[model samples]
Target chain A: MLEIFARLATLVVHDLIGLEAGTGLGDAAHFFVEDTLKILFLLAVLIYLIALVRASLNVERVRAFLAGKAQILGYLLGSTFGAVTPFCSCSSVPLFIGFASARIPVGVTMAFLITSPMINEVAVVLLWGLLGWELTLIYIAVGFLVGMLGGAFLDAIRAERYLQPFLAQAYQQGSAAAAGGGEAQRLTLRQRHDFARKEVGEIFGRVWKWVLIGVALGAALHGFVPDGWIEENLGAGHWWQVPAAVLVGIPLYTNITGVVPVMESLILKGLPIGTTLAFCMSTVAASFPEFVLLKQVMLWRLLAILFALLLVAFTLSGWLLNLVEPWLTTGAGAGG
Target chain B: MREIKVLGSGCAKCNNTAERIEAKASELGVEARVTKETSPEALMQYGVMSTPAVVVDGQLVHSGSMPEPGQIQEWLQ
Candidate 1:
């Protein structure tokens, strides 16, 4: 009995501090705990900042303006504007909520939401710098067209009816406040500065967790996933691979900046350009997290439409790449 | 003091709105304090739902799209 008690106590102490007394399990457990804790702490700080920003938004005036715009024009403008923005996935959600609360036509808002992550100046510059002018121009034109058309399609569906009851009510309240032209409150310079700080914090807070999760997932895949399998299975001549890659990508999200390096590495490792591009598009344009965030503002029906549009767009882009792969490689490879 | 807030998540449209507002303020020589608001909370408080929203004197003047520089200047006046 005395010997057993001593062994148990030793085991407990070892496990508690990840020392593994006499075994190697303690070291592995310690490493895992340390890495995970670090990630968790970083994510916590990031989310706190995002939440601070989100809490500070003024939704009423935005709702009033949305009520005034032409739905189609709004969608077109939203999509076009989304393409020019420099926002990452997390920052885009607050913007999405603002549109929804503002009562901007759902379809148009969807258009902006979709295009914002897909097309951007950074992505464009990177694509051009890494790929070439031809591919870059094509991506921009296609991305913009898809956003415009997708928004119009969603608008035609009258997708706004799907908002959660609570969000809808909040939107109404905001509109009402705007209509009353409530007493204008002015903020002093110091107040505005404070407001800005809080806002950045709030926005960052809400999104940091998602960003970390995404980064961790990406990092894990980067570290452990076998590129040869993806290359062999999804490479050219496989018609189904295009759609499959896009479908796989929709659930995954990452910024173009993070994805570009991985993509470059994959391409170098014999991964099909089309497969890699499809993956990139899916990660950015149709991310699951983006959908989850958009759900806060949009109804299910509109979200579905947005998803379908992205699916088709990304699939087509992948397929088209396969078609032109031979020519592009021949022309571009010589320079490389 | 006049307060102007540009709301968007540091995207191109948001930046454009900010630039336009600055240009408008400069052109009119309006004594308004111009600031960029990228927080979801601040944007929601103003009822702005789109990227690149322009709020003048705590009133949301534009949302969902970037207003032209000329139009922004007009709004400033």
Candidate 2:
């Protein structure tokens, strides 16, 4: 159905408008219209469905649940909760302090914080729609591992000692003085529907421009980059390429919404899958503004450690995935 | 007079919530002072995990989103 719409659009632009098929402008116009329609439709449906299923879930509940859990399980659950929770970066300071004051371990809170930016439902939906299930699953796994492992590492180093003095004291004193969350209320179907509809509006409103800008960039890359040029010059053969992509990603910032379309274009352009994913993940998760916000709760030492941890994780994942890329694509083709 | 504090990390929603409360207070002819507290310490003290939380006269009344206009009027009155 979506394909038919895209085709009709292409036909209108190509025949009714008199743009030739092979021209750069013509092809880009087709790519832009098709991608915009497909991505927006997918985003609205998937976000609403996901929101409906988890409408009862909120940060307060997540905090209460994660507080005082066992170490390993806490890390896993924290990362999982992070992915499912809809968190704005500005909430990081309050959320961080709230979790810390509740006596949740630094590592567990860090796990939630790390994964929250990298793997939200919107990110998952965009990845699945643009890159297919195999890559989406892999991206999720990588996000979890990065969060869990990073959290564990912070714990091993006793990262709590480096927190802002008040938080460190709060952690040490085991102050459950913070407001315990309200009891969970069962929601009617109507309430869930209302929540999901509002979610659709807010999330779509925030990301629609990102979709246009991202797809425009992708279409430009698709139409203009000579086929096979990237494969020949920037393929998996180069060891430094992965880290280079990650390094380039550090200064640039965009949410996963804006980066996924670019990821699709890069992969299709024959840039290695691992390299593309690494770059996009770094851009979304490891930007300066996020770190600055985190600085409210964390001292510089801990902040620096997190920065390095993310860079290393992205680079390593990039290399590992590139090594296994042919196998992955083959498996995806067969199964997905 | 009521002392209303909007707690958040200075996000746009926090500002908007403060504005709405202030507007509703005057419209209702209630003498209310609406303030934005951006400090993480203030939020931690209140135990607010989700933000744009509203504290009316030193008690948390609403949180997690911008207050509806009805909620604003109720708070003022």
Candidate 3:
């Protein structure tokens, strides 16, 4: 269905615009049009549907649900909710304080926080659209694993001791009362439509530029890079490349919406899947700005620890995925 | 006079929420005092996990999104 649109666009560009097929500019133009249309269409539809389902879910209710749950179950549910929940980064501080004061385990809260950015609906939809299902499933599984294990490890080390002074005091006092946000009431169809429409507008407004920028970058690579150049230079999947890709991604900040398209082009160009995944994940999740935001809640030591933890997780997963690349890609190559 | 506090991390949306409330109050000829509360402590006190949450005279009334003009008019009244 979507390929038909790409083909139609290519026809229009080539026939009407007098651009020759197979030329760099022609291919780049076709790529930009096709990907931009596909991404925007998918994002709007998926976001609206997800928002309708999410109308009843909120951070307060999630806090109420996770509080006092069993340890392992708490982490699992926390990470699960993080994946499904629609969270804004601006609310992180308040959410952190609320969770901490409610006496939810620090690790569980960390699980939620870590998974929130890594496995959002936007990320899932984009990955599925750009990469094939096998890779998407693996990415989701890795995201959940990282969150769960990271949380458990933090708990084992008693990481709550590293909270900022005021947060520690709040935790000790347990000043938070019931975490509930009133009982859920069934919404009328009209209410759901309004909410979903607003959500589509808000989210689309925020991410459309990212989609364009990402697809444009992907188009540039698809157009200009010489064939077999990447394979000859970097396709060996050397173990050291994973860590280097991770380190390179640390300083650059972008969202998953902006990185998935780039990932598509990299894999198509013969870069190792694991190295590309590591670079993209690092770009999305591990960044200076996000850590700076967390500094409001966590002490410097804890922040550093979190940073190192993410780097290690991304590197390890990259390596593991690279080791299994042969089996993973036997039948499935990166899809458009 | 009513006191309206917009609680958030001082993001653009938070500022816009504060401005909207202030504009609505004056437009409705309702005497109101508005403030932007960026403190996490204030957010905790109100049990708000999202922002820009609205606190009218110490009572949290709405949260997690931008306020509509109609909602602001209702708040003022």
Candidate 4:
């Protein structure tokens, strides 16, 4: 598939535009252009499709669906909703309020919140395209586990008291309005098209700069970063590598789709699967901006705990994957 | 009269927000001009990173989701 892109890219850049393509610098330039186009195309199409699906629904339906479920069911449903929902992490606040006002437990809400950012369709699709099926499945499973367990842990500790007081007041206000019964209107096809076009523009416009930067960095790493140095320092066998990756990844703002190529390059430079994926997960799921936004509704202690939970879960997942990787490789060898 | 800017990417929620503001404004007997800003740059000008923000008279009144009718009414006044 990438070969097909490469051939088409060569025809356009080299044949049509008559640019250089047979040298090292040319290859790097081509790689960058190809990757950028690929990601942008993918982002535009997938985001538009997701927006189309999202356009047909309202928050009230999501609220009603999740309002009265048990803890485990809430965790399951919340995580699933988070997975498919097109919401950016910070933008999910209204849904968070809906859950709160509906009296859904804080843990369940956290489950929704965590998974929404961590394992959205963008991440899943990109991981599948770049990293293949096993890794993608692992990402999904770990994301779900983190949401479910993190939520349950928060609930077990009675974290509701840690919410900002205004959340309750706001929820009460919002709930009263909701209970008064407003009708949900269906959007016309033209309206859905316009909405999707606008959403595609918004998301693609915001993330394109990051995509270019990420691809450029990935190209550089692919070309210049040495394998031996990386393997010696941060290879799979290193016990501290997973936690270190998580800590470093926490401050970065790139999404999984943006980070996967860089990760692919790092893997070429001998970075471990566990460590690379750990970095990707934390970068997307545990960023500092997400915490800053949550502070509007949650006390610092609860936010800190939530961060810590993700940190621990990702680190453990990394270590466990590293442990099982050799066995999986051998199993594959035997089977295939 | 009020200048109500709905900071959204023109998604359903944002449209809903714009409509609700219009509804609330008329229901309360307030004459208001409602506009929707879909551009990221325009949204940033209002310091709204999230879509579907309601800005009334150039002050950001709400963001991060659809504003309820009551919240819209509260903000408009």
How well does model 2 score by local distance difference test? 0.85
Better of 2 and 4 by lDDT: 2
TM-score attained by model 3: 0.96
Which 10 consecutive positions of candidate 4 chain A have the poorest summed lDDT? A327-336
For TM-score, the strongest prediction is: 3
Q: What is the lDDT of residue A20 in candidate 4?
A: 78
* TM-scores vs. true structure, each candidate: 0.54, 0.95, 0.96, 0.77
lDDT of 2 by residue, A121-146 (tens): 88887777667888989999999999
Mind giving the per-residue lDDT tens digits that candidate 3 earns over A223-306? 889768988888755778989899999768877788888888888888888888888888877678777778888999999888
Task: Give lDDT tens digits, candidate 4, residues A282-316.
Answer: 88887777777667678899888887888898999
Alpha-carbon RMSD, each predicted model: 15.4, 2.1, 1.6, 7.2
- In angstroms, the error of model 2 at A334 is 11
Off by over 4 Å in 1: A1-72, A91-93, A168-232, A327-336, B1-77
Q: Fraction of true inter-chain Cα contacts (below 8 Å) kept per model?
A: 0.44, 0.88, 0.78, 0.06
Q: Give candidate 1's root-mean-square deviation (CA, Å).
A: 15.4
Off by over 4 Å in 2: A177-179, A330-336
Show where candidate 4 strays beyond 4 Å: A9-27, A168-185, A328-336, B3-77
Q: What is the TM-score (0 to 1) of candidate 1?
A: 0.54
DockQ of each: 0.19, 0.85, 0.78, 0.11
Q: Rank candidates by DockQ, best first.
A: 2, 3, 1, 4
Residue A63, candidate 3: how far off, in angstroms?
Answer: 0.9
